[model samples]
Target: MKALRVEKPNNISVVEIPKVRLEKDNEILIKVKAAGICGSDISIYSGQSPVATYPRILGHEVTGIVEEISKSVTKFKVGDHVIIKQTESCNNCYACKHGRDNVCVDLKVRGVNIDGGYCEYITVPETSAYKIPKDLDFKTAVLIEPFTIAFQACSRGRLQKDDTLLVYGAGALGATVIQVAKSFGCKIIAVDIEEEKLIQAKNLGATYAINGKSPTLKEEIQAASENYGPTICIDSVCNPKSFEFLVDIVGNAGRVVLMGFDTRVSEIPQFKITARELDIIGSRLQHDKFEKVIDLFARDIIQPKDMISHVFHFEDIEKAFDVIASKQFRKIVLTF
Candidate 1:
């Protein structure tokens, strides 16, 4: 067996490792087929992620074929195609008991807290794996995890049909948000400083794509929303600037959902929140959205093929990291 290991911050290598087997009746062994490199993976590589542990395998957005299944695993078989949820929670926790396991007190994200699918083989609990249509390609299935994040964000926003949505970034996640919102019949306003990404957003069904660097960004958003301002604003950038701007762009009583990761303390405007009665919500990982995303893919409601701009062989894992660090592509996948 072989795996990509991050021995420490700023160090990663592909090394031969011992093969793993299903040791529990509730577990299934999968042969890794494709995995997506995420922004958090880049953070872990650069020593920027707080949750990442050293000497870890760095891949969570995974799609693989089942190589073996325990006798007790009746939900899956040896040849099934599946996507990994990555986030495994302790079902006994208060959050889990309330159907909020995504925020479980003892949440263990596969790639971050344990060995992930950055190798030839991996094993995961049957509960965390969802079967996908056998017709779906492995490269496309790899996107299910990231797409679920967007799905959960939109779910948190409680976006209504025909409502206007303002998205704070036009990167991969931002594009997903745009597509998901569009699927729900919401008019989308995508904001980003990169002109190319804004163009991509427009192609992804955003009604209006505003450059974050525009001198009249607020005015553009206002005009796009027909002067009432967007009813829902999702901050996928999660920086102080985007957070404050989200507060400013949303209409009165609008919902604001934060989906990006940032550790720095943000100075929020208490007055704006109090005066407008805005509903500020924080969305974590995907809840029960994987199946919906797969259905969306099947029905062509959200096409991810165009979003995947790059692919690399498993042996060129380091090169893939370099491309991700450079922000040269919308989505990058590693194929075994």
Candidate 2:
């Protein structure tokens, strides 16, 4: 099998490796069809991700066909099209027992903490595999994982139909937030430094697009929300500066969800948070949202294809990473 491995910072290559086999009775062997490159993958390549280890196979957003299944795997069989839920939780943890497995104390995210799907074949536990719609192509199916992040963020922010949402960043996750917020009937204000991404956000149903670089960004957001600040703010940029703007642009009693992850710590405006009674929430990976996102895609509520700007082959892994680093596209997928 051919797997794309990151040996260290700024080092990645496609290397021939032994094929994976089912290690547990509850595991299934999948013939990877398509895998999406995430920002975390780029972080791993550049040695920025805190959790990622060296010589890791870097891919987590994946879709595949079940090539083989262990005898104990009755939920999935051969030829079943499935989407991988990269987060594997130890069901015994307090969080998992309380229905919050996404944040389990002993959680392991494939591609980040372990080997992932940037390969010809991969093996995962049956519990981590969900059957995708047969009609959905692999490229689009691969988006379910990322969409789940957006969905979880929106849910965490307690987005309401009557609320106005201010989303920072118009990258892939930000675009997903726009689409999800739109589905909930929330008016969206998409903010980004890139005009191209802002345009893409508008096309994805953002009611307003504001340049984060603008001198009066807070005023613009206030005006967009009819003289009141946004009722909810989502920070997808993960920058300290964006975090500051999130606190500044949200209305009194508004909810702010931090969806992006960075190691650097940012100062929190304690006075504003207390004076306005703001709710600051942190959203991590998906928590039981994959199936719902898949349904949304099936019903055309969220079109994954529109977000896909580039597709590369397994053999062109280096070129793919280069393009991802360029940040010119919304989403990039590697087809096996």
Report, for every candidate in turn, its global Cα lDDT versus the true structure. Answer: 0.89, 0.89
Which stretches in model 1 have alpha-carbon errors above 4 Å? none
Give TM-scores for every candidate, taking all chains together and pairing residue i with residue i: 0.96, 0.93
Inter-residue clash pairs, candidate 2 = none
Model 2 agreement with the true structure over 1-336: per-residue lDDT tens digits: 999998888888899999998889999999999999888888888999988887899899999999999989989989999999988898998999988898999888888888899999999989888999899999988888988999999998988899999988887678889988888998999999999889888999999999989999878888999988999999988878778878877899999899766667788859989999999999999888988898888898988777688899978987887777687777889999
Instruction: lDDT for model 1, please.
Output: 0.89
Number of clashing pairs, model 1?
0
lDDT of 1 by residue, 1-336 (tens): 999888999888998999998899999999999999888888887888988888899899999999999879988998999998878888998999998899999998877988788999989989989999999999988888888999999999998897899989988789888888888998899999999899889999999998888898889889999999999999988887778878888899899999867777777869989898899999989799999999998888888887788899988987887787787677889998
